[model samples]
Target: MSDQELFYLLALLKVDGVGDIMAKKLLTHCGNAESVFKAKLNQIAAIDGVGSSLLKKIHDKSIFEKANEELEFIKSNNINVSFFQDENYPDRLKHCIDSPVLIFSSGNINLKNRKLISIVGTRQITSYGSEFCKKLIEDLVPLDPVIVSGFAYGVDIAAHQFAVENNLQTIGVLAHGLNQIYPKMHKKYVAKMEENGGFMTEFWSTSSPDKENFVRRNRIVAGMTEATIVIESADKGGSLITANLANDYNRDVFAVPGRVTDKYSQGCNNLIKTQKANVLTSAADLIYILNWDVESKSKAVQKQLFVELEPEEQKVYDFLLKNGKEILDFIALQCDFPIYKISGILLNMELKGVIRPLPGKLFEAI
Candidate 1:
């Protein structure tokens, strides 16, 4: 959008009683932010929840001054701003009701037609969590998913670091403005991160890393991605909040289960037990659940034509061949093998190009 358009959009957001939903309503009715300001009082009041008091606040001129200040910040710092309706805005995030009308970003970021997954967890990450996160990213490298996180310590940084080490794009959703980095310790990573993925935020330059900003920050982390994965989280923490936000958005949520005795695992364990998230045991689980492996099905089927299958592999392969395609649970039941055992067999078959995994646990003989 042009600077004049963004100036009006920024001003509209500053209106006292107007938030994302109300702002969207006004924009829909009036066509644009500038139009909303120029529209008659009756036109603005016609929108739902627009009381006389809000209508009166719409005329506040001070908001324009604030908007101009932010516009200057955007121009001077080379910050990139995305209006909600802009093509550059996150596609998934645009569908969210509470998404910010304008998001500020900096770096070399491109999410078009790309797979995005957020990996978040407790600030005090454990060795188990770290290893699981590392291996998960390594295994997922083949799929080349864009890794997203809050850029905090622990699982967030670990996820970003692994993505960088593996040469994958990773984005950090910050709680504060682009002008500064929180946990100042993380300042060192700013340059490297901006080189590939960069940072995103809805907060303005004047906004600080306040307590409430983090909660709002979590939504973007959850909203923009195709799925949110909790590598490890305490019974109560920011990651769980993000998981809930992902669920609210009707996005996939996965949590890594750990021992019940482990404090950090309790939140993830609870998420799985309550059916809020899928059980994420490995990269295969995510690949299988999300159908990332489906693209290789045709190739696997071609390879299966000449490859010899083992007796056990042949049995599973025959069942899949006849069934066409089936979920992992059903394959285990029909084949008379344990579910745990089926995964290993399936992997061997996958390597041999005998069968392929599909989304939502389905598997088929290639």
Candidate 2:
């Protein structure tokens, strides 16, 4: 976009009542941010949700001053700007209604035809969660997925580190502006992270890493990826919020199952119990569910040879094997497992590579 347009968009965002959704609607109605300012009061008010207060806010010239100052920071710092409608904007994120109208980024990041998955969880990550993140990324190296996270402590940082070690692109979506980093202790890793991947944020130079901004940041994490995996979480945390947003966006959600007694495992266990997330026992489960098709037959077969099934799962597998291809409900009925319970079993079986899902909710043993 032209400098003039960028200036106007920045100002539009600064308007009190205008947010991403409203900005998009106004942009759609008025053609551009420049035009939104030029449009008459009656014309602007015609659009739904464009209230008198908002129209008055649009007229306030102070927004322009703030926008101009931010523009200078962009020019001086060499910050890359991505208009939501631009080719450079993340494809999946553009589909989210609340995605930022403009994003500021710095790095050598590339997203062309790449698989994107988000790993999120508690800031107080445990050893189990750490190892899981490492192995998951290591096993996924062949696919070379772009790992996206909040750039915080625990699971987020671990995901980024694993991606970097594996030489895969990684992105750390920040809660604050690019001008500064939060959790000052993490500053040491910034240079290295920016070398291969980099940081992205919707906040402008003036914005701080406020508590509310982190919640807003979670939406971007969930929206911009094909799937979201919660490595570990307490009964309540921001990662669970990201998982919920992914579910809201109709994206796949996966949670690592842990023993019920583990404090950090409660959130994930509850997600699985509520059927909000698929049981993520291993990287293979993610690959199978997302249909990544990144594994070789030899590698897959090798793993399948060691696949151990629970007695209940074995019953379902044997039933599918004898029946050739059977509907989901029929398998549940034949196995004498409730439909809800059978779904999880089938998902686990699919993860084991013991069965493949067919069209019309059918399953056939491999």
Candidate 3:
């Protein structure tokens, strides 16, 4: 479709109560956004949800003029827009019941990746959550999967940062419009992400970051990815909404196990116990659950044995290898080393491919 037509479709979406299903019905009857724009009051009133009241309001010339003005503003801002029927629209999200009719983007987006995993968790992530997110990203890096997450604090930030560091593409599905980044503190990381990956939203540039918008935003994250991973969430956290949405969308849901006594872990543990999400202890768990077929991942593991490491690094690696995965605190205790020193050694070992980090601040030998 032409740019003007696409803009008109997006404009229609901004109308109150004209959601995806209703808009689609109107489009089916009228043929396209242009046709809908040109429809008479009576013609519009024939469609579902288009009552005489809505039809009269839609027929007002002032509304169309305002829409046109908004279109002009969007054009002036150089924001990238996509309609539901466009070829570039993300296929994974297209089939969702509440899929947006238009999406505004401000970064490089590759929607064709076969493997997309979303990592979401509490904004107030503990050290355990951060470590879990870091290791999961590192393991998924070699598989060349596209990482998706919100650009919020905690697990979201860690996921995006690790993806960038590992040279993998990451997409931040924002709750607000592309006109600005939320949590303004993450502006630098958002800028860096635009250079490497991209940002996406259904809201217009003038749209505010309202509370309801975030609940709506989680659907996009859940719909666009092949799987959703909840790193660490409280019993009532928003990450649970995303996981439930993923399940509704027929996408895999994985939850990293956390201590039962910890408040932050209650959601994840509940999900696993209730069979709402698979118990994910490592990246390998995710790979298997999704049935990802990257032979290279296995080859990368087998390429070298006895990976070179410093004595301290080797100690950490040997300990993890022998004991399976262990949390940082536990590893430190086992190795009789200071927590700070053990952290440095583990990071070096991770870089040297001597071990792999798991979600929830755990590490295991490759």
Cα lDDT of model 3 by residue, 1-366, tens digit: 666786677667656667888888888899987788788777888776777666655555655666776687678887778788788887889989789888888777776644788999998899888887887777676568888898888889888999999888889988987778898999989767877778889887677889899989999999988899999999998899999999999999999888999999999999999999998766656765576654444445553655667888777777887899898779989999865466556655655666666666677887
TM-score, prediction 2: 0.82
What lDDT score belongs to each candidate, Candidate 1 first? Answer: 0.90, 0.89, 0.80
- Please estimate how well model 2 matches the true structure, expressed as its whole-model Cα lDDT: 0.89
lDDT of 2 by residue, 1-366 (tens): 788989999999999989999999999999999999999999999999888889899999999999999999998999999999999899999999999999999989888888999999999999989988887787676667899999999999999888989998999999999999988988888888899889999999999999999999999999999999999999999999999999999999999999999999999999999999998865656776898763243355455456888999889887877879998778878889865467667765655667877765677988
Among all windows of 10 consecutive residues in model 3, the one with the lowest summed lDDT is 294-303
For each predicted model, how many residue pairs clash, with residues at least 3 apart or on different chains?
0, 0, 2
TM-scores of the models, in the given order? 0.85, 0.82, 0.81
Model 2: residue 337 alpha-carbon error in angstroms? 29
* CA RMSD, predictions in order: 4.6, 7.1, 5.6
The better candidate by TM-score, 1 or 3, is 1
Q: At residue 27, what lDDT does model 2 achieve?
A: 97
- lDDT of candidate 1 at residue 106, scale 0 to 100: 97
Clashes of 1: 0
Give per-residue lDDT, candidate 2, residue 35.
99
What digit string (tens of lDDT, one per residue) describes model 1 on residues 1-366? Answer: 799999999999999999999999999999999999999998887889999999889999999999999999999999999989999999999999999999999999999978999999999999999988997887677667899999999999999999999989999999998889998999888888888899999989989999999999999999999999999999999999999999999999999999999999999999999999999977768877776653564354457437877788889999999989998878889999875567667766776676777667778876
